[model samples]
Target: MNLVNMQRKHSSYLLAFFTSVALMSVGTARDLRDVTEPKIPPSCTTLKASGGDDTETIQKALDSCTKGKAVALSPGVFHSGPLNIPSGVGLVVDTGVTLKAITDPALYDLGAKTCGTVDDVGVGCKAFITMLRVTGSGLYGKGTIDGQGNVTLIGQKKSWWDLSEEALVAGTFQNVPRLIQINNSADITMYQLTLIDSPFYFVTSIETNGFTAWGLTIIAPASARNTDGIDPIGSQNVTIAHCNIRTGDDSVAIKAMTAPSRHISVLNSHFGHGNGMSIGSEVNYGASDVLVSGLTLNGSLKGAHIKSNTYRGGHVVNITYNNVCIVDVKNPIYLEMDYVHLHGNRTPEFRNIAFNNIRVLSTGIFILQGLSDSNPVVVSFNDVHITKGSRWSRHFANVTGTWEEDASGHCGYAGNE
Candidate 1:
C-alpha cells in the first residue's frame, strides 16, 4: 500500500473533516447567547404621570421598543421619576404596576459621584439613583418596583447638616435614594417584583452579568440603615429564586473584586430581619462558585454568613449551603476571618465549605474564626439540627480547622437535642 502512502492517508482524512465542521459552528454561537425573553407588548398601558408632569408619556412608550419587546405596566400609582430602559428594550410590570418614587429626591439623581480619586471610583460611585435605571442588555421586571423613601435611618435629621461646602462641593446626595441601579448590565431578569422602601442599597448589581432575581418581595424597614436586600455586585451567572427578604441589611450579598462569585444560586428564599446570607463584605478580589440553597431564616441576624476582611486579601473557595431553615437565628454558624476595616493582614483562604440540610431553632452561637496562620475554613456538616434557645449554648468558638462530620449519620454535634 504505497502510492506515496496513499497520498498521505487522503490528506489526513481531509483534515479531520474540516475540524469537525469548525467545532459545530462554535457550539451554535454559544447556544445563541441566551437572554431572549420579553415580548409582552400590546401597546402597553396605564401611565398617568402626575407628580408635576413630565413623565414623557411613559418615556415615549419606553422609546418605542423593538428589540425583544416589552413595555407593559397597568395598575396605577406611577409618579415616574427614574425609569430609563433603552437597550434591547424591556419594562414589563403586569401584576399591578406601581412604579412610584418621586418625592423629589432630585428626580432620582443619576449624576452619581461622591468625590473622585482612588482610580476615579467606578460602579457609578455607589449610585444612589432610585426607581429604575436599566442600562441595557435585556432588563425585565414583572410589576411593583416601588421605592418611596424612609427605609429607616433611625431618628433621621442630618441631611448632610443642611449642606454648604458649596452644597458639599456638589457631588450630590441632597436627599439620598437607591432602589434599583443595575450598572454595566448583561441579561438581567427580575420576576414578580415588589421591592419596597429604600433610601440606599435595595437592589444593586454593579458590573453585572446574567442575573436573575425570581419571585421577589423585598421589604425594608427594620430600621433600614444600609437597606441591602439583594446586592450581587461584580456579578456573574446569579440566580436568587423565590425571594421574600425583609431587610435592614444583608439578605443576599455576594460581592466581588477578587473574583469569587461564579454561577451563584439561592433557592426558595425568605429571610427575616437581615444580615443573614452573606459571602464577603466585598472579597478584595476573590470568591468562587457559591450556592446557598433553599433558605428560610425567620428571625435572622446571622445564619450562614462567611465574612472576610484583612484589608481585602481574597480567596473564599467553593461554598455550598443546602436546605437551610432557621427560626430564631442569632448566629447559627458564621465564619469570620477578621472583618472590620480590612487592610492587608494577608491570611484569607477558605476552601470548599459545605453545610448540607441545616435546620435550626435557636440562639446558638457557632462561630468559626480563622486568621492567624490562615488555612482553616474547609467545613462540611450534613443534616445539622440544633435546638435550645433560652439564652445560647451551642458554641464552637475560634475554630482553626477540622470539623469534618460527614459519615452521613446525619450530624448531631454533641448535645442540644
Candidate 2:
C-alpha cells in the first residue's frame, strides 16, 4: 500500500523464485535420462560348480542372494571363499565358468593369525580370492574370474639380510588377493569378463559410482609381479572401455582420494606389457574430467603416464590424450612432477594437460620429464611423432613447461633434436 505497493510485492516474489529454478533443472535432466542403462535382471538364481576342483561354497552361494538375485556359475573350479556379493547381487559366469582361488592359504586363517607387515613387506594371512565383493547398488559380473595362486610378494624376495628378518617375521609376505574388489559400490557393470592369473589387483574399484569395465580380458604375467589391470580408486563416473590389458602393473590406474577426480574415460584400449596408461601414483586428492582416447600400446614400460608425488600435493586438470599408439615403449610420453617414488607433499601445478595424435615407436626414451621449478606443469605436445629406435636419445629432464613442438621434430631439447 505504500512505496508503489511495496515494489509490486517484491516483483512477485522474484518471479516465483525463477520459476522454481527452471523447474528444478528440468527435473534433474529427466532423472539423468532415466538412469541411462542399468537394468539387467532376468536370471534369478543358479549357483552351480562341478569341476575345476569344486569345493563350492562361494560365500555360501553369495549368501543365498535375495536382493535382485542372480548367481549363475556352472563350469567348475570354484574352490570358493571370500565372495561377498550381497546387495542386488547378479554374478553370472556362463561360458565355462571358472572361479578358482583355493590354492589353500590355510583355509581362512586356521592359525595364520591375520598376518600383517608393510613396507619392509612380509605380510601374509592370504585369503583374498575376492572374485566379487560389492557393497550394494546393483553389482553385475559376467564370467571367468581366475585368481589362482603364484602371486608372490612376501617382502618381495627379502635380500639385505632377509630385510631385518622379513621385518620381524609376523606373517612374512602375503598380499596376493584381488580379483574383483568393488567396495562402496554403486551401479557397477562388468561385461564379457575374463580375468586370468590374477595374483593381485585385477579389478579393484574402491569408493565407486557408475563404474563400467566393458569387453574385458585382463591377463597377467608379462612377468606378473604386481598385476594391475583396472584400478579406479576413490572413483566417480568411470568408463573403461573395450579392454584387453596384459598386465604386470598399471594397465589402467585412475585414482583420487577426497573427491575431485571426475568423469574418467579410457577408450578402445589394448595396452600391452604393463606399466602404461596411468594417472597419478594416487594424486592425493585432485583430478578433473580425464579422457584418454583410443590407446594401443604394444610392449610398454611407460606410455601416457602422469605421476605426481614430490611429497603428496595434487592437481591434474582437464587431461586429454588422443589417438595414442606407441609400440616398443620406454618412457613414451611420461610427465612426472617429482614422483620421487611417491612419498608426499608435492604439487605446484599440473595444469590442463593435452597430448594429441601421438604415434611413437621409440624403443626407449621419448620425452620423460620431472617437473619442478616453483610449480610448473602445463604440458601440451600436439601431434607428437617419435620413431628413433637405435637406443634412446630424446629426453627432457626437469621440465619447466611450454614446449609447442609440432612440426614432427619428435621432441628435442638435449641439444635440440
Candidate 2 whole-model C-alpha lDDT, 0 to 1: 0.60
**Tens-digit lDDT track of model 2 for 1-417:** 322233234444554553343234322211121223344555556666655444445556656767666667666556564555666666776577667665443443425443322343434433343323454433345567776635333334332223223433654444335667776667677776787877567787776766777778888777655578988876777777777888888998877765545677777777889898887766677766677767777786988887877665577766777667676677877776666665544553566566666666455554445454545655544445556442332223322112222223332211112
Instruction: Count clashing residue pairs in model 2.
Output: 14
Model 2 ranges with Cα > 4 A deviation: 1-70, 75-204, 208-216, 219-229, 235-250, 257-277, 281-297, 300-304, 307-327, 330-333, 336-362, 370-372, 375-417
lDDT of 1 by residue, 1-417 (tens): 422233244444454453343333233211122433333444434454354543577778777766566566666666665666676566666666677655453444346533221122223223333223344433345667666554222233332122212233565433455667776667666766677876557787766767777777888776655678887866777777777888777888887763445666777677888888888867766776676767777776887888886776578766767677776667877887777756676557776576656777554567766654435655545455566432222222212112222212222221121
**Candidate 2 least-lDDT 10 residues:** 26-35
Q: How many clashes in each structure?
A: 14, 14
